[model samples]
Target: MNIHLRLLLLAGAAIFFGYTLYYIRKKQLDLYHSIRWFVLSALILAMALFPELLTVLAHVAGIEIPSNLVFLIMIVYLMLTCLSLSASVSRQHARIRTLVQEAALMEKRICELERRIKASEENDDDIVAREAYKDKSR
Candidate 1:
């Protein structure tokens, strides 16, 4: 790579690394999510510092163009990230569904209890009124 490109990559990697750390410290990004960003930044820094490594990787992977290797790596990484995020979203959706079902069941139970309480109160009032009537008759 040219000197200008290398310098740009280095600066970009440094900025990305710093941004990742800042978000982690601020509690916006957790450790699990920050790991991928850290790795990505480190890889960029490595490639910028030693462009020869890319050539060697490309040769080993049987890719004629080193740039193509970079593209392939990025594509794979993005695919894995998307898969992980999708799985997480699915789990959250299931948990939310369970929570809604449980809430509905709880509401039903509460309504039933309230109805029973009202019926018991009415029965007690009738007994009290009947006793009062017998006492007056005596």
Candidate 2:
């Protein structure tokens, strides 16, 4: 509602767009979904700057509203998007945990191999020493 808040929101929107574009170009972000997020972010930023835009649009679409319907719609969209993202994050986390478990098992196997090799070497040394002592006593 204030001038400073409006400017900050505008700056934030600019940064969001810039980041989205840079990420897209680098192939680090999803194309379709990122664009959807970008558009939603930009629209929300615009609406925040001038909330009357919502009223005007609603009126154009023959909707009478004294309440915050537009804000509710935006919130719902963000909620669904975030829910999907959270599910994806959860799946990735599960996969990473499985990979870590596998790596730990591999490391344990390597340690077991080293222990076996060392034990075999000690047994071989003991046999050689006993044979040498017998020959010396003869």
Candidate 3:
């Protein structure tokens, strides 16, 4: 690789290593997210490091020589990242729905118990009234 490419590769490696160390120390980001960040960063940096390859790819895709290859690659990379994020969001949404259903069911059970207690209290009052009437009759 050329001197500039070598420098870019070194920078990419440094980012990956530094980020890994930071994550290990902080325990903030998940493995998947970190890996994704590493891969995307490397892809972008590598592309910058090798502009000629991009020119050739753009040509194959019928894009003009001076076309916006960088933009095209960025668009594709963004699409992939969005897809992954969408899947993660969908899973979390399903989990939230399940939790909501469980909470609703528990609330319903509590209401049912409250109603039963009220009914029992009413029955007890009726019994007391009847007993008082019998005592008066006696």
lDDT of 3 by residue, 1-138 (tens): 245654765576578667766985698888767887677667767666676787788888888852366567768878998998999999999999999999999999999999999999999999999999999999
The Cα local distance difference test for each model comes to 0.90, 0.79, 0.78
Q: Candidate 1, residues 1-138: lDDT per residue as tens digits?
A: 567767977997899899999999999998998998999899879878887998899999999977677678778977998999999899999999999999999999999999999999999999999999999999
In model 2, residue pairs whose N, Cα or C atoms come closer than 3 Å (at least 3 residues apart or on different chains), thus clashing, are none
Each prediction's Cα RMSD? 2.3, 5.4, 5.2
Between prediction 1 and prediction 2, the one with superior TM-score is: 1
- lDDT by residue (tens digit), candidate 2, 1-138: 345645765776788788888899999998966877698767758766786776787777676761255656677888988998899899999999999999999999999999999999999999999999999999
Better of 2 and 3 by TM-score: 2
Best by TM-score: 1
Clashing residue pairs in candidate 1, if any?
Answer: none
Poorest stretch of ten by lDDT in candidate 1:
1-10
Each prediction's TM-score against the native? 0.80, 0.58, 0.57
Q: Sort all candidates by lDDT, best to worst.
A: 1, 2, 3
Global CA lDDT of candidate 1, please? 0.90
